[model samples]
Target: MSIIKKLASQTAIYGLSSIFGRFLNYLLVPLYTYHFSAAEYGVVSEFYAYAGFFAVLLVFGFETGYFRFRDKNDPQRDSAYSTALWFVLGANLVFLLLIRLVRTPLSEALHYAHHPEYVEWFAIILGLDAIASIPFARLRAENKAFRFAGIKILEILVTVGLSLFFIAYCPPLYAKNEQVWFAPIYDPGIGLGYVFIANLAASGVKFVLLTPQLKGLIWGFDRVLFRKMVGYSLPMVVIGFAGIVNEMLDRALLKYLLPHDPLMNMRMLGIYSACYKLSILMSLFIQAFRYAAEPFFFAYADKSDARRVYADVMKYFVIFCMAIFLLVTLYIDFFQYFIGREFRAGLGVTPILLLANLFLGIYVNLSIWYKLTDRTLMGAFVSLGGALITIGLNLWWIPHYGYVGSAWATLACYAAMAVVSYLLGRRYYPVAYDLKRIAFYIAFGLGLYFAREPLLTYGYRSWQAGTLLMGSYLLSAALFEFRGLFHFRKKLPAGDSGKSLGPGRK
Candidate 1:
């Protein structure tokens, strides 16, 4: 298959798990919004934000390490796998013990001293997830997309079921019948505790699903290969830490910078998070694209025309991502209802956050140059720049603008990284990306987005306005690129079968 077709297939499978899984998980937004106060949900959001950081720490970038080493025709593939597994397992064990020892102090530090179990159980969840990362990466390396999708979907299902049972059904059942099982553990007052427990259950299920990947493997650790993988992966640890901090530090810092009232501050955070879910429509596409693109890029890195392919991929990526951005933003009037009515007030941040994700996707594509060239330290530097931008912006703006500041921080940080990566990639490994064409698409999308309000004033409902905006963009693209769309099955000339038309070529 061609790269585009292969990407489409993999993206469909991965998107099934991600889009549907997130949709199912999104049900929790409304569930929590209705059941718990905004502040309570904020606690859940803030805690998970911190969990994101710890997750990167515990895994220590071995997932990417697996991808990097698995590509080599080493005699010690099994040994490499086993070594990476044991390394993460050892780190997770030590981290768990340390968390246990410092549980009190950590709880006190986070202002969750009254609910230290949140810290404890969260540590367990992150530890299990970290250990599970090895087998998960192996699945990707081995091309087990179906199994990957199944396991992911199953995990989401289990999490949703448990969450509903605890938060929605259990309380009333306990009130009506004290003999009900699991009632004591289902404390309604501990709003965020249920979220943690659900995550723990889901992570456990993931471990079980990965049992097949773990079996029949040599558990013996190879110190030499271990050292090599660690050398390759350690930089990634810094990159991953910085990358996650860029994404999450705003939420974590919000609690500290905001007022002392945990409940009130968390409520504000919850609103931000709930609306943020709406932005995931764009993010999910970017994630699925990355899942397929990374492996494909690395596999094709040696092709003579790989640079052209990379450039084409970036153009198409921006086109589709911008389309998604427009779709979500134009029709947010409908999607915002996914969260509760009370939380809809934060919908103002959706466009800003969506643009941030778009920039983030672009940066990911740009960073591939560094990854392929083995100059991953450059990636660390880029992400560190982004992290600094995120922190600096949050500190300056969150105090004045609240969650809106978080939105701006995300946008500014990602835009800076995207610009920097493009500049640096040109210096290190240039690809002729269609910056002019991509900018036209973005400008067109933004113009359509802003014109929606005027269109709606003419008796068009929001959904109708959205449909027209999306349809216009599609029609314009089709008109301008009709040959590219229609010539998919066109045969090459009789004497030139090996040569084919390039992107945007007639």
Candidate 2:
């Protein structure tokens, strides 16, 4: 198969987990928003925002580091895996210990002193998740996409199932009988803590399920390779921490910056975060693609047409992302129902956030250059710049215009970051990206999004306008830009019309 075809197939496989699993998890948004007040949901949102920061720190760029080094020591690829695994494991244990030492004070500082267990739950969740990172990366590197997807699906199933049982089922059961069979497990006062507990359980189960991947592992560490991996991955610490800052600092800053009661501030943030799920479709695709693309890019780096494959991946990624943008934005009236009505007030930010996510995805694609060229320091600089933009603007905008300002800040930060990454990538490890087509798709997608209101003015239902616009956009894209991919050749004996570039399989 062609590299693009392989990428598409693998993305689909990973999507079975990343995309579908997230979709299943998406059900939790409704459950949470419905079960908890916007303010309560805000507390949940804030902790997860903090979780994003720690998650990045706990893994400390080892996922990408493992990818970069795996091929270097091909004779013992497991050396890279084992070293990366041990490095993250040690870091997580220390980090969790430190959290244990300060859990109460840390919880108080975050204004969650009433529920310090949040600290303990997330500490364990982050540690287990960080340790699971290498094995998941190994699955991708080994092209075990199906197995990866399966475990991922199972994880989400357990998470979502338990969340529903706790938040929805147990309460009614207890109401009927406080002496119910699961009484010990159910606590109504704990409220949103169940969300964290469910997530913690799911993450722990995933870690256990990955025990097979951990077996037969050598315990000895290579000091030289360890230093090299650290040298390569240390910069990722900045890049990742800063990237999370860009992605999540708004929610964090909003809690402190909003001129309202603590609960009110959380309400505002909850609203922002809930509506932000409107862009979850794009978010899901980016995740699935990232899961597959990182290892794919590393593995294909030495290909005769590596640059060409990278370029194709970039163009196609934009095409699909743009398509998602139009589809989601046009139909957001329905997606708005994913959150409660109080949160839907922030739906105006959805389009902007969707575009921001699009740019972020492009930034991730452009990032392959730095990863491949071992220019992680440059990547760190770029992410630091983006994080500064995110912070400065949130500090400036939240007080003046609320979460809308944060939304615009997100877009501006990512747009600036994408341009900066592209420019630096060209200078360092250039790929001839199709800028004109990318610009056209984005412009066209935005144009269609802006037209949604006008179409709705004609009294068509939101879904009707959405479907009509989506169809028109797809048909137009096909006629003008995607027609060539439509042409087909007679099947060869082996089914691939393109020249077989490797050893015969049959």
On TM-score, the candidate that comes out on top is 2
Candidate 1 has an lDDT of 0.83
lDDT of 2 by residue, 328-397 (tens): 7887767888888788889989989999999999999999878888889989999999999999999999
User: Candidate 2 — number of clashing residue pairs?
Assistant: 0
Backbone clash numbers for all candidates listed:
2, 0
lDDT of each: 0.83, 0.86
Distance from true location, Cα of 326 in model 1, Å: 1.5
The deviation in Å at residue 216 for candidate 1 is 6.2
Which ranges of candidate 1 are over 4 A from the true structure?
71-77, 181-191, 216-219, 259-262, 484-506
